[model samples]
Target: MGSLRESLNRFNKQQEKCQSTLTSIAASAAGSKASNRTTTTPAPRAVPASTLSKSPVPAVKFSNDTERLQHINNVRKSPVGAQIKKVIDLLFESRQSFTAEQINEACYVDVKGNKAVFESLAKNPKVNYDGKRFSYKSKHNVRDQKELLKLIRTFPEGIAVADLKDAYPTVMDDLQALKAGRQIWLLSNFDSQEEIAYPNDPRVPIKVDDELKQLFRSIELPRDMLDIERDLQKNGMKPATNTAKRRVMAQNGNILNKPKQKKKKKTEISKRTKLTNAHLPELFRNLNG
Candidate 1:
């Protein structure tokens, strides 16, 4: 009975040891699985440093109220109109809508404080205002070459470039192509250099008569401007003062003080010349007289 009890105790001790070993293996596997899960899960992406920071706003400085007022006047008088108009124009060109505050920040102009300006813009025929944002209301929506050409043709004289400001960004490109194709004429003002677009008109060819051609060929253009001036003066027409001619004459020589040629005495020539037969005849005739 003692031997049997000892054997049973030994068997129980072996079973407990095996159970502990299995538990340890299971624990280790669970720990490895947890570690793998932690390693496999991705970390959150880092945000860019540039996106976190905002750009600096530009400041307009004035020395006095008078200068500030003058600047405001100048801004109002500009072809684009006041600060609000400029903001609207910018939005139109960009083809994007923006709030007044966003526009102020983007354009570097503070129009939020000026209620009058906003009122004027809201009332403007070329601008559209939503409850939150402002957009451009195009007078003529010229998107492509065909539309541009059609609009240009509507104006017989010519269409001002400023009038087509609401057109697409590719309007200039279309204009250039049309100009190259001789489908349109782009003329600029002499004083302002402001571009104007004119449609190419194809009219019936006028055949010049031979007599008319001959008459045109026979007509002579005046070559001498002095004759023209003299004729104009004789006809009671006062000639325009030729400043360019005066300047040229002044540059060539002084017109006021002209040096006169010194006249030589007859006796002065007698000393330089040898006595000839011609001189002897004149001397004898003078002596006889």
Candidate 2:
């Protein structure tokens, strides 16, 4: 009798499992039919980070003509010049320092976005990963220049000409020029105790806008192919459909600055109802009656 009871329990669990499998199949079939009947656009689905662990790419925007010319010169000077500039800009703008591999990953995104531009930068002697960090080893490294400027810009109690002399190689020339240009007094009374520091109309670092930053944090895009073709199309930045490559290159930055989708705030949604007061009499009156 005990064996018989055990056999019956096992049989009941198997039956329950079969019932659940059947129920799931029926629901799936019904869902398929519903999907076929629907024509409305569904809400966008977020891709899982596990499935798409790659960071979103963003097109880097040269903040001003000075930066643009600098980038152009970089491309002309070093094979890795463009990439070095890009990494420098990223480091300056970033809230934290990144590893060399991370920098390489970001620059390689350029390779994916623009083959020619990547090749040009790849030929640079100054840009190489030291198995740990990407270094711009130029005699006049922009990375060093920018770092020194950052220190100067954020110098507490302000920096003196003497203090800056060690950091800036051309300090004497810069001081003399400032004096000749009637700007010597700008740093003459430099304080070193105050929290806020602003030195002699120092070259302010370029700041990427919030929108651009969001894209960078989202997309992780590279410098040359600042604008991906797919993104450009969405922003209505299409060429004459058959425009020259040069023409496309000329308009690359313009297209990349295209607006991204703004996330709408979700309000509390109530359950949807098909019946209103007008239809209630015809639909519900019969049921009530």
Candidate 3:
């Protein structure tokens, strides 16, 4: 029992010495700083909520709608002014009511994505939109009142107000003004169901001007007109009346109302006259008083 106790005490003392040595080694290692030693501790680099909350916020970019509008305004004031004027003139001259899409088609513009041309057209005083469609005010009336009267006098077949309205919606107003002034007498077939007339119909006869007359006359009669009419009758091949008129004018510019060559009459010589040709000397003899 004495040996057993001595062994236990010795074991305890050895354990205590070992623990002390381990503690001393740990302290020495912590105190020592080597030139090439790497720290095992991880760095605390995450952004804290307090620092993030105080940082400046970035600015946002926005579209300049005013600048876009100003750009459109500038386009209106440019040389395109003449083009717009011409388009307006055509709407009246053709006596055709045009929708926004039609106007764009006439101008060779694509208004599906582009708004400038459409917005510009809306600015005209005569431009009125009936919810679904757009049309001009003075479609049927000639811009010059004198011209309108002259045309009516020349072709007394008289025009439908709707036809004129289609070309120039203000034609009725202009004609009314003329009536009020006692300048011209106009007739309407409006009440007659036999003559169908609509508000947007352009009723004026497509006039054959001297230039067009000359152009048509230069070509052989029924042939040229037939060819053109037949071509125009084709599906999807028909051009606007105004476009067709212009095309004809362009093609026949230099050619005027020159007459076509007629077939010559062939005369046959008489058998007796052929025999008389041989007896010409005998025919010269007798002179009677």
Candidate 4:
């Protein structure tokens, strides 16, 4: 009975050890699973508040119909289209692609009414229209002085300033620098006052001979403007003003319309009455006789 009781105690002890070992193994497996979850799963990143929130665009306003029309005229004059010259200016200035609906929303124009303009833009070589949106395709990609200089050199006659403004926004500064450097010449049109740029050719230097230089130095201009004017008139030049013609006409009119003075009839009595002056009359009496 003593040995049996001792054997039962030993079996109870072995069972408790086995249970404890199983519990330890299960706990280790659970810990490993929790560790793997922590390592494998990615954490969520925080987004920028600025990127999430955008400011609303301001609405365009005009005081009157004339002001609104002037604004529209200015937009029409922008560098864009061949005929219409309106919608594509927005695309050019923004340098972004926009759909027909988007363009209408931005400009507040009746796209349906100006359907022909949009159709023309689609066919225009300077505009790039994909199946969805349209973008501005610049004719000249001049950004700096070097590119501008290269472009100016290409045209020997001259490039129009109006055309350059279309290519580069800050072309005026580049042109000014070029002019200061004596690398280009800016000439103004007589009637339009539009500037034309010509490249300065360093290869051809202005050369004057000694005789020509002396002739230029010895040139004597007439001080009398009347002589100069007469010579110019003789060479088939006409008077620019009517002042000279008016002066001559005024003088002639005064002479023709002037009043004439009547002469006194006292000369007939002088020869007969010459003897009545005593001594003074005697000296003149021989002449009177």
Candidate 5:
């Protein structure tokens, strides 16, 4: 029993020593002056949390958040938000992919505002972060004609020029190029006072000559104007306008009114015909008398 108690007392002493050593080590690691202190005890080596605290990470701190909010808001409203906003705005405005590093470099915001907003954007839901880059959702960078045409087609009513300007700064030039290529049409909307463009519809307009050919083939006689129009449409031929039908009818009328060639009178070919053929010799003698 005595040996047992002695062993237990030694174990308790060792445990207390270990705890004191650990406390000293934690304190030393937490502060810089700890390394200078002399110690009679050996400390166990382990990984530490202090190193993680020193990285140059962007952050916004709050003590009394209620009071800090106005300051934070001021920062956001003033330039921090604006700076970060410009980064995204330009990115969205440029309508292309941009990295956070690129934004950090190109931003022209004032130092204080620039600093706060740049860091805060990482958490902003309005900004799309793909680990390395940022982008605005509604606007996409269009680099070529095919992509531009595709975007216009996606919006049926028409994409507003104002909205497109945010994504495509030079939308007019692009639309003009598309128009010149015969890939789209630029239409003026008077009510809204907005000019819009749209891709060509799949339906093709039929030629007037083609329509005339088909109409004549299908009908042998004159038909009512309305009936002709309906039949032409029913036959999958588009005259394109009401005037086209009128022109066709006028042309057909000229054909029907053409003057007929007269036939030669049929009579016996005999002595009379022979005398007429020899008219000069016999008629000359009579004339002389």
Candidate 6:
């Protein structure tokens, strides 16, 4: 009798599951018929992030293609959707931010409507706004590994990683991937965190006095460098790191200057000179003057 009671309980659960399945199917079928009968546009359904997940292959399950197109038309007719579409189209044309005025002109929407859509959509995680302009947030717009490397080279003091993440959330994984590969470095001090992609470590910006800048005008070798550094240290000077040395070179506006090639001394050749003249070009002889 106990075994029979257990079997009955199992059957009741199975019956409930079957009823739930039938209810879902019937609801879907009824939705299809309602979509076919309705001529008016229904409210736009918000597509969930789960629905947008990338799939390897496309699958179309419903026969609601006509209804879908009509819904799309309704979205286009709606002010908010139309404005968002304008922003998308503008981004496709130019990834640069579009000003409210520019969008109003191009999309032919009134200023008030444009402002409303911009303010609303600006809250979206994927929409980017700069107080006055709008753009679609994209990873490509953010500094990639190569660009971060370039930034490392440019700003030797290092870039705040948090600031970079704020600018490009999409590239967070890319940045982490590069970090994992040891292609870049994440560093921190007492107050801040930064990324350094260049091989040379970045140093804090320091003001170099003219005398020190003159001393490091050209790179000094170990002996001269040690002597100069020792002498400067006696005067309470900080030893110049590579970044400091570069800053000095840049302050003088010649960091990018190529080393001056030694000019061959042109000796001036006398028109009436003999072998005693030690023949050389007249220009060479005149170089001493």
Candidate 1 residue-wise lDDT, 198-285, digit = tens: 8886563457999999999998867777777777789999877664587688897856667998998655334445546665665644
Cα deviation of 62, candidate 2, in Å = 32
Best by TM-score: 4
What C-alpha lDDT values do all the predictions have?
0.78, 0.54, 0.59, 0.77, 0.66, 0.64
- Candidate 2 on 190-240: residue-level lDDT in tens? 245422224445344566899988887897654444355555677889633
lDDT over C-alpha atoms for residue 155 of model 1: 92
Clashes of each: 0, 14, 15, 0, 2, 11
Q: What is the per-residue lDDT of model 3 for residues 237-276, given as tens digits with 9 covering 90 to 100? A: 6643455576788899946898989989875444433344
Model 5, residue 75: distance off in Å is 10
- TM-score of every candidate: 0.38, 0.18, 0.24, 0.40, 0.36, 0.26
The better candidate by lDDT, 3 or 5, is 5
Model 1 TM-score, all chains together: 0.38
- In angstroms, the error of model 6 at 170 is 3.7
In candidate 3, how many clashes are counted? 15
The full ranking of all candidates by TM-score, starting with the best, is: 4, 1, 5, 6, 3, 2
Error of 6 at 26 (Å): 57
For candidate 1, the per-residue lDDT at 71 reads 66
On residues 22-114, what C-alpha lDDT tens digit does candidate 6 reach at each position?
A: 999999999998988785667788999877996768786877589766764555467776667666666545656777677656654443454
- What tens-digit string does per-residue lDDT give for candidate 5 at 1-289? 9999999999999999999999999887877555455453478777688976687888988576675556545544664555666666776676666665565445533333345665676667557667777767545556566778888888777766655554455666888888888777888777788878776744675467987889889877545566667778899997545856578888788366669889998764444344554656655344311
Q: Comparing 1 and 3 by lDDT, which wins?
A: 1
How far is 94's C-alpha from truth in model 1 (Å)?
Answer: 1.4
Please give the TM-score that candidate 5 achieves against the real structure. 0.36
What lDDT does candidate 6 reach at residue 237?
90
- Looking at model 1, report the run of 10 residues with the lowest lDDT sum: 280-289
